[model samples]
Target: MTDALSQIRRIVSARTPEAVWHELAAALKPFGFDRILYGATSNRREGSVGDIQDVVSFTTIARHPGRGREDMSFFIRTPMFRWVMNNSGASSWRWAEEQFAKGLLTPDEVAARDLARKSGLCAGYVISFEEPGSRRAAALSMIAAPDQTQDSIDAMWAEKGDEIIILAQTMHLKIQSMPLKVHRRALSPRQREALEWVAEGKTSQDIAIIMGISPGMVEKHLRLARECLDVDTTAQAVAKAAMFNHLYANPTGEPKR
Candidate 1:
């Protein structure tokens, strides 16, 4: 078991979110499930209030018929998940709730019940992380069901909960380092300069002048940022970087740095 865990850690270190998602599904072979979805909560600002929503989900299946990634966005918002989040009966869930309730559940626990119901699931497990050093909390939800008895699968999940927790933490670290890896690869000195400014919410033209480059150059850096982060747009890249502390302009801006 220890050897398997070490191997899993190594795989996680070497992969993207997509790869990690599939690897996680494979690692969970002990539990007989037709589908697996790992959904992480969106990172929101402190004292900046709104719905505490989750975004950026990954999914895999085990010999089953269902919707693909596009279909996932709809199911993650179900009432069943909200009910479970509100009352999971798991010790970890209760602890997470207590922590978030006191100033927990960032953005104040988004009403995602509708999303959860759409997925057609019977059981769910949720876990939260502290984003390394910040008080900010991030949550992940995993839901499942299959021909195997619920009692049996629940037992497996309980026994393997610690392993899953370790996986989550390691996965979190990888995400937080993704941008730095990109920063080292293709970003030029001026491009990097523009990127840092961009990370701080500066416009392309603002970044261009700061880096003594053209707005076009700023646009180029934005494109690189998106490619490196494996996201679609500059805004997503920026949000991902800021939330994960993958890359930062001010050393003091991120809690761990």
Candidate 2:
């Protein structure tokens, strides 16, 4: 118990997202689950995780990117994705099976299940978390060991489900409190600073004065920020950056991975 507590403490205090993810995955390894995917969104719509660009996610599943980068947007069309967007609780992979048996699943959902079976991802647990804000949603998916059957995993869950849920919740909250950084799309210090100023309700001229630059230079910074964030306007850039904590990132520039 003391060792578990110590590990949990370390996980929460980890400075970087990579550290936290590695620790979290290590912690779950003994519980027969080694593959985990954590995803959270602050801009969810009725049945979506909102813009994929705005999602905060970490994964342990190896995508074999050397072959080809996986299209993560495909997750949006999966049954589990819809369930997380619509509900707030832990559910078994059995739910998907039952839905399929009852002929209640859509064609796309059935196809998703077939693919999961082919990929050895057929047995797992999904926890759709209840967030404090209406616009927020988070979920964690844990896949059992390849040698484990769905029935065996379910029996284990019955005995240790509460502990599993608590650990996942802790991980989600810890990740939320940490910095959000994306290696694929890191903003420059000037670009992030410009977005921060915009989020603070600063105009072009106001930001220019505050940043010690001309209005045209301020406009250029904001424009570059919008482009970096892949947003159509400064408002969208500010909203997206703030949502991901990019606005609060190190002005010294993101550290190398």
Candidate 3:
């Protein structure tokens, strides 16, 4: 109990995703999970968690070239992703086996399952974080050591499931509050400033006045910002930048200078 609280403190104090991930990995290591994958996205819709490119994810597993770790699209094709999208809480990997036995798995899911087994990832646990707004989905997959069986993991869960869930939830909330980095090109300070002013309901000319720049330059900044965020309009730029936490904070989770 004391150790859990201390680990949560370390996780909360972490300023960067790498720092937090290290803290989380260390905290879960003793529980038999040797590797972990954590992913969250705010761009999801019904029955889908959106694209992996837009998700803010961190993994402890070594990402080898051409493996599923490098190509996260592999995860999206798995039945576990479907389960996390539809449910909450922890689930034993055997649930997928049962579904497969009942012929409930899709072809892609079957392929992913078979691939996982070949890769020595047949036993593990997954936790689906609850979505309060329904516009987002987050989950963590913890892969137990190869020597650990599903029955052993289940027994461990029976005793420490709540503790694991609490740790994962704490880490999730911390990660959410931290600055997010998406696959899009980062907006420049000028671009971020322009969008921030626009979010404050300022026009291009107004932003130019506040930023001490010409209106045409302001328009140029806004245009570049839109392009960087891959949005069609300045309004969409603001929303997308804000959605990824790029408008208010930097990668270090500190105020933009």
| Whole-model lDDT per candidate | 0.51, 0.78, 0.84
Tens digit of per-residue lDDT, candidate 1, span 1-257: 58567756765655455555566666555545555554444443442212322244455632443333343444334332344334322333233334445753433243443233354544546554554433333345555554554466557777877776677566655554443221124434454455568767788778777778788877887788777556797777667566544554432223342
Task: Compute the lDDT of residue 74 as modeled in candidate 1.
Answer: 41
Deviation in Å, model 2, residue 144 alpha carbon: 0.9
Model 1: ten consecutive residues of lowest lDDT: 47-56
> What number of clashing residue pairs does each candidate have, in the order they appear?
12, 0, 0
lDDT by residue (tens digit), candidate 2, 95-151: 888888999888988887788789888788889999989889888888888988789
lDDT accuracy of residue 192 in candidate 1: 47
Q: Cα RMSDs of all predictions?
A: 9.4, 3.4, 2.5
Cα misplacement distance, residue 227 of candidate 2 (Å) = 1.6
Whole-structure CA lDDT of model 3: 0.84
Error of 2 at 101 (Å): 0.9
TM-score of each model, paired residue for residue: 0.52, 0.87, 0.92
Pairs clashing within candidate 2? none
Q: How do the residues 1-257 of candidate 3 rate in per-residue lDDT, one tens digit apiece?
A: 59989999999888887688789999999999998888888888877767556777777676552232353566777888889989988899889999999999999999999998898888899999998887888889999998899999999999999999999998999878776766667788999999999999988889888999999999999999988877798889888888887776764565346
Best by lDDT: 3
Model 1 deviation from the true structure expressed as Cα RMSD, one decimal place: 9.4
lDDT at residue 95 of model 1 (Cα atoms) = 37
| Model 2, C-alpha of 58: deviation from truth (Å) | 1.4
